[model samples]
Target: MKNIKIKYATTFTIVVLMFANVSAQNKSELLLQSKISGVIKKMALEEKIAMLHGNALFSSGGVKRLNIPELTSDDGPLGVREEIKRFDWNSANWTTDSATFLPNGSAIAATWNPEMANKYGVVLGQEANARKKIVMLSPAFNICRMPLCGRTYEYYSEDPFLNAQLAVQSVKGIQSQHVAACIKHFAANNQEIDRGEINALIDQRALREIYLPAFKAAVQKGSAYTIMSAYNKVNGYWCSENDFLLNQVLKKEWGFKGIVMSDWGGTHHTAEAANNGLDIEMGSSGPYDQWYFAKPLLEAVKAGKVSEKMIDDKVRRILWVMYHTSMSTGHPAGSIATEAHGKAAYDIASESIVLLKNEGNLLPLKTDKIKSIAVIGDNAIRTFASGGYGAGVKARYEVTALAGIKARFGKTADIRFAQGYKANYKASNSDEQNAGYDKPDRVLIADAVALAKTADVAILCIGSNREYESEGHDRKSLELPFGEQALVNAVTAVNTNTIIVIMAGAPYDLNEIKKSCHAIVWSWFNGSEAGNALADMLAGDINPSGRLPFTFPATLHDSPAFALNTYPGKERTTEYKEGILVGYRWYDTKKIDPLYCFGYGLSYTRFTYSGISTDRKTYKTGDKIDVMFKVKNDGKIQGKETVQLYVSKVKSSVSRPEKELKAFKKVLIAPTKTATIRISINVNDLAYFSEKQNKWIVEPGDYKILAASSSKDIRQVAEIKVMR
Candidate 1:
């Protein structure tokens, strides 16, 4: 009896401590809120209004008398950009500002590992802190609706789940350093053509299922502190002042407590914007005081055109974010261009190189037998670290493919180089400026052929550069630009032991290459360590594991948007007629064959999938569906494999896609060893947004669960029933 009494007393003490901790945290939060309220109350109308607009190019006004420093932001989704002048677009040219250039968004997504995304965020946050930036304007994850979209390299996959998974981790990782991550181009800002004026006509179901998941997850789950409104219009409203999007869905439904800033002159109106949802106006033209949220807002408030309470709310949110960021205690002093940062860049780039075709097993080049290597192409030597329309980093150093190859194999083999093509592109040039740049240069091609004929092996690097695939304009076609097809044919006809390395962000015309080339590799505009990572992969130091984030259609016409003739829309309005059937969904449902399906990739080592099952044959709503499978390394060397799980409804009253990706895991295994893998999916995740009900509805029915290597490479399947 005495022992039992002692045990009860201990339990009571533990409970008391838990409650005390909660109370203390609550008190701290209340104190912060009280302080914020006091600051807001003390500010005059003009002072509060001043805080709502930009005072310079990359900063907004703050209360100097109250010790509130100006909130500064830097462009990202690559790395911290170089410092620019206060009042102009010219570079500040500070030698100390050079930073680490991380891999682009598509490269990270190709890794198919959310851990890499987290690492990327960590690097970004640290660098931002080092620059004393309040907000890191990054993680621009717009959906890749069309392959021709110039910003496809900057966005994630076509799948909402994949985008959501990466976005949540990226946000958490950035915020982990107490630096605010600003998620950008909110809602249907897919294409670059007419971005500021184009109206994206999207239905509610498609918006919920396809376009907005990543931003939603970033806000609700990752707790992002700032959002950048897109330059486009959704339906009939500009995103900067869209009431349904900002006020209703984001603020009320998702409970986002962050400030919404304009995307550099993306603001349209003064009164409408202030009343609708905009909190900060940035990058508008003319005098700072004349900006939409500057003097106009003050006048609107005094005339009762906009409420003073609304101004208080905006100030309160900004102050709240400030406390969490610049004013936060214990914020780490960030580092840039360090060896650790470079290694992080290398890790992502190494895994991002996808082996597309290896008909003769020509890769992992046997260095012992090779006497000379013919390295050809302009991309082999071109540095993509800086030249692009959107955000680009002033890299401390960028190792080109040629540099990496020479560093790796110069000791043993004689390496020769030839510029097979010229990247005749400049950001200032118009689309039609270099009209004949795509035509083959006879002299360059002949020189490349002559070099290839003499060497035992040839490494042909060919693809689009940053200028070809950029932010202001989409590509005219997926054809290998700069007459690369002719160059490839010429070089391949001489050297049968040639390895083709195509580097670009989005899918391109690979039909001819697939037919003629025995070996092919797909690379990206990867960052500073790109060449080093590529050399390691070719030398067999690291196995190729990156997967394709989106589907590669056989031709431009094979894609849904182009096939439906709905792209670039007629009269500045484009309707998403494809709806939820995007990427693999469109291909699978329509019985169309893609050149390469979503999540498709090849590795030197092989892995086989078997023994697929579920924990239960039946489950209720909110129950977890546990899926079990086994993957064995069937090759002689160890390799990493990304196991994908897709779910399909067997029978439904409404129309649905054939299947959808729910969860995935990347695992490494030793040669001849099998690893058992288990992935759990919430039954609620199986539901689709119903247009009729305007909410998600999980129907009671049997669903087919598929375990696969890729979207089209399903290996095992099982059935389970969901009860009401």
Candidate 2:
């Protein structure tokens, strides 16, 4: 009798789950049939209004009920965003803290390997779910509007393919934990000038090809639960209320089964946003939501301007998402923890940092007599400086280089400190912009130089700060702050053992510093345990394994589209004349030299790639080509290798990049050990977005597939023919 009862219960559970799975497949079926919809219909106007106002509420360890409605959210993709921000009780229902100080998205994009990105998402998800957050408002896909754009750090890259691939893979990882990922800043929101009002008047060709691909890709492939519309207008209509953007392209063509949430302060009018499928007004509580969510939305319904069906659809989508996340896979919500999260962040961030330049055999520092170490730059001590402004810089802990050194070598070692340059630039809140701090103090560099003369090694930490780079404003130039270059020049002159570390969101000009500094590390704003990670790399505790996420141009002027001027600016037009030639592809195709190539990073260990062979010499429309290469460690220490594969179209309608990165992998090998890697490529990898063709066209031709350690360093070569 006991066994029979247990068997019946198991059968009932399976049938229920099966029913739920089938119910989820049909979006409309769930909208009409789910009990959540009926409850929504029975709700008073105020109760129904509450569902559309997405307020920031904290619940960790388990679920919390709200008399209003409970919606969850998190920070950027590199990690779970901090949710301690306070909300403006007046206008926006969303959190006003607006500062979760997460690492920039471009930094993740540089890693190239999707698995690494997905790993980042999973870790972020673990934290979000543990905190009872239902949405991760990140995987920012904005274009790198300019080399200097402040928010460039928030975006993936200038290249659409890399951005789309990284965003999609990351979303899959986050959703794996039952949390929703929002692929954001919908449609041509590249610039910061008049961001709340400027129109992005892009032609359809550039819009569809360059700006829209990533958004489309994420919606089409990834498990994106929501999309936050931008503040700016696309063409003529604001993104939050754009009909074609919300309905035609997103819903009809791409079939994004997600809510359209408005960016903080992005809602202009409640009715306009709602009619366009803008489901929730985040952060706003005033005219749009507080009043709108309460009066106007229901008023529209009663007036037949909107319907019970429409309101029911919106509420059902919200409740269904809640239910799905509450019981994701085996674990329900609230399983994430803070333990090991900081450590895991350190590991991933340590791997993400790329060694841009290592010269004179100065790195992997020999520590016998190198006692006196001069640590320069204000950033050496500004722990939270590595992350952005929103969510307010936080971690259970931070690993500063100074702490790393003390932990590794103990306090007995001689380590002198100096602020190479002061980060005191405080521009006014608005463009009358002349207020708090004037410029970076040059006298600080002179003081650091004097200290450097007494030390055997000079560790200079210099780069842009949160003030100069974040979500709202864009950067103006690629150059470092005032006197930093001169500071770098002075420090390296006194101590040739100088290693310059640039801790920033976007890439900066380092030509002068490279000439004098024996070694250089480009550390993107790493989080929490960033210091320990940097210290480990500096002390040779771990091998340096980071690659450039975006192309490092010799000069900002050298960029192909530089002449296009201020993008999405007050002028309302930012032409993409370079078309699809972005990142290394543009530099390679045009035969121009980048200061540092994309997919470029240095490791303490040496890796040799050889024995290039393929499963076949030819391919058709849907065939996959397996290209294999053997990588051997030639260095004394066991280390990892990032094998990058480039697929070149020997001939094309338009000239191609000298070669394009089709696929890559970061493989680990033991000292003197050999590891084999095989990467598969599809037809999509070989096609180009032709403006005239208006389609991704693949020409019949011979293609050269090359395997290399870096973009410029080709190790082995193979060939295949495409027969149309």
Clashing pairs in 1: none
Stretches > 4 Å off in candidate 1: 1-27
Q: Lowest summed-lDDT stretch of 10 residues in model 2?
A: 59-68
What's every prediction's RMSD, in angstroms?
4.9, 6.0
Error of 1 at 660 (Å): 0.5
How far residue 316's Cα lies from its native spot in candidate 1, in Å, is 1.0
Please tell me which predicted candidate would have the highest lDDT against the true structure. 1
TM-score for each model:
0.96, 0.86
Tens digit of lDDT per residue, candidate 1, span 1-724? 9999999999999977866777776767777889999999889988899899999999998999999989999998989999999998799989988999989899999999999999999999999989998899889889889999999999988999999999899998889988899998888988998998999999998999999889999999999999999999999999999998999998999999889999999998988998889999999355999988988888888899899999999999899999999989897899888999999999999988898998878889899999899999999998887776878899999999999999999999999999999888775687699778799999999999999999999999999888888888888898999999999999999999989998899999899999999899988989999999999899999999999999999999999999999998989999999999989999999999999999999999999989999999999989999999999999999999999999999888778899999999999999999999999999999988998899998889999999999999999999999999
> Distance (Å) between predicted and true CA of 66, model 1?
0.3
Q: Give the deviation of candidate 2 from the true structure as CA RMSD.
A: 6.0
Measured on C-alpha atoms, candidate 1 has an lDDT of: 0.92
C-alpha lDDT values of all predictions: 0.92, 0.72
